[model samples]
Target: MTGQGSHPRHGLVDVIHAPVRLSIVAALAGLEKAEFRFLRDTIEVSDSLLSKHLTTLEAAGYVQIVKAGTGRRPRTWVSLTPAGRTAFDAYTESLKKIIDAGN
Candidate 1:
């Protein structure tokens, strides 16, 4: 698990391993989706930084981003993909296994 190393095989999602990315994933785990402003504020990350992380997550097919609104500018909404939820679930399980290994 996440004890002394990191990797998918080690129960860690590399793309989501960074502190910020991990926090992003964790934050999105409980919601159907979160708006950009809400996520930025909650994660305490700058717009650029959050954009970068979102891009990474999107590239991995772990997150879905959509734009919608009734104006010239559309609001951004992001949520975990099915694959993402599955991955997160597996990661948590693996982490638990590691903790239980010595018990």
Candidate 2:
């Protein structure tokens, strides 16, 4: 695992180390909060994949899931915690720096 300080040019390399997880985080970063289905559709991933990524993020304490009963169906909503937002912002900044360095 890469430490945040190891890659001065990419502080978020650790957070987005997995491509799928990276995409998941990126997608979540764009929304204030989103439904599970919405995230799955936006990311174009299967239920298993989305669930796996969400589990990972949840375990990392980067995301929060809210379960609510909506009539006959149950709705699951996901949102980034403050820690997640900070991590995502740092990751984006690192990516920008890397791109700038390459240019």
Candidate 3:
């Protein structure tokens, strides 16, 4: 058994565990990609807030961010990396384990 207070095997992933980041990952998990504005609105966060978390996720190699211009203005899109998808899957499985233990 692990020492007291030590993380369980397959414990929650720290980087993607944050509420906002979790929501972001969950949202992207089902899609090929999502527009920045769509995520901002769906997650109900400010532009800067979403941008900030996205940057963190990007740095962790969990997500990719792309900026492009269609016409007059630039657009940003976000998607999960393979690593992110794997981590998210693990996270959900860990969550299920925890919930089961509590039952």
Candidate 4:
């Protein structure tokens, strides 16, 4: 994709581009792994909103969700996959280059 200037823009994988998803990924990058509620709170999104973003990330192979326990209060943990880390790094680098060009 192309931006307003001459810079080529990066495309969001099935996982990273959405605002909520991007926030989720950024938060996950800072933690070893995060619980569902932690991510929901960190991203300041509703439970349903977080869940939807997580589902998309999971489907895109960018994140993995582990479900523990078998009852009503099962704990769900989310982590970024190697693919996700690489994608996030690439996105940040691309942004940096764009910023540097304007300097």
Candidate 5:
């Protein structure tokens, strides 16, 4: 019998557990950086919703948000941090373990 009592899913990072946040992380994982509007469109969330989730991910050190451009047009960019990538890798491994457990 296993000594550990907790499920592998318990190892999931709470910050990235939410659907929207998870989507954000997953999307960022494949790209060096993406514009905020592109992410919002890809994730199918409103600007405010994306901003809210980005704030949470930023607070958790899982994402970096940058604002650029000048004049009438400014752009926001988002990317996963090194720490975020590490955490996401671990989270996916935990999910794999969970799937294996069910098999």
Candidate 6:
């Protein structure tokens, strides 16, 4: 058994554990890709906050990013990579396991 105060962990994913990132992954999982504004609005976070989380997920290889300019405006799009999908699936399973353990 783990020491007191140390929580039992099985397949928990730390990166996606953050509420915003989890939402980001969940939103992207259902779509091929999503625009920055769409994700920002869907996640209900400020632009900077969304960008920060994207950067973190991108660094972790959980998301793919592409930037382009439409007319005079630059647009950013993000999608879950194959790795991201796998990680998200694992995260879901882990969360389920945690919940089931308490039952």
Q: Give the top-scoring candidate (TM-score).
A: 5
| Of candidates 5 and 4, the better by lDDT | 5
Q: Mind giving the per-residue lDDT tens digits that candidate 4 earns over 13-79?
A: 4357678888999999888899998888877989888988888988888889998976778989999
Q: Give the clashing pairs for model 1.
A: none
Instruction: Name the weakest run of 10 consecutive residues (lDDT summed) in model 2.
Output: 1-10
Q: What TM-score does model 2 achieve against the real structure?
A: 0.86
Clashing pairs in 2: none
Q: Model 4 TM-score?
A: 0.84
Q: How many pairs collide in each candidate, listed in order?
A: 0, 0, 0, 0, 0, 0
lDDT (Cα, tens digit) per residue for candidate 6, span 1-103: 3443334355667999999999999999999999999999998999999999999999999999999999899999999999999999989887777778799
What count of clashes does model 6 give?
Answer: 0
- Give TM-scores for every candidate, taking all chains together and pairing residue i with residue i: 0.83, 0.86, 0.90, 0.84, 0.92, 0.88
Task: Name model 2 segments beyond 4 Å from true.
Answer: 1-10
- Candidate 3 root-mean-square deviation in Å: 2.3
Off by over 4 Å in 1: 1-9
Ranking by TM-score: 5, 3, 6, 2, 4, 1
State the displacement of the C-alpha of residue 53, model 6, in Å, after optimal TM-score superposition: 0.6
Lowest lDDT block of 10, candidate 5? 1-10
Q: Give the Cα lDDT of each candidate.
A: 0.87, 0.83, 0.91, 0.82, 0.95, 0.91
Q: Tens-digit lDDT track for model 3 on 38-93?
A: 99999999999998999999999999999999999899999999999999998998
Which candidate leads the pack in lDDT? 5
- What are the candidates' C-alpha RMSDs? 4.1, 2.8, 2.3, 3.3, 2.5, 3.1
What is the descending lDDT order? Answer: 5, 3, 6, 1, 2, 4
Candidate 2, residues 1-103, lDDT tens digits: the string is 3543545464755755688878888888888999999988988999899898889888888999999999999999999999888888888887888788777
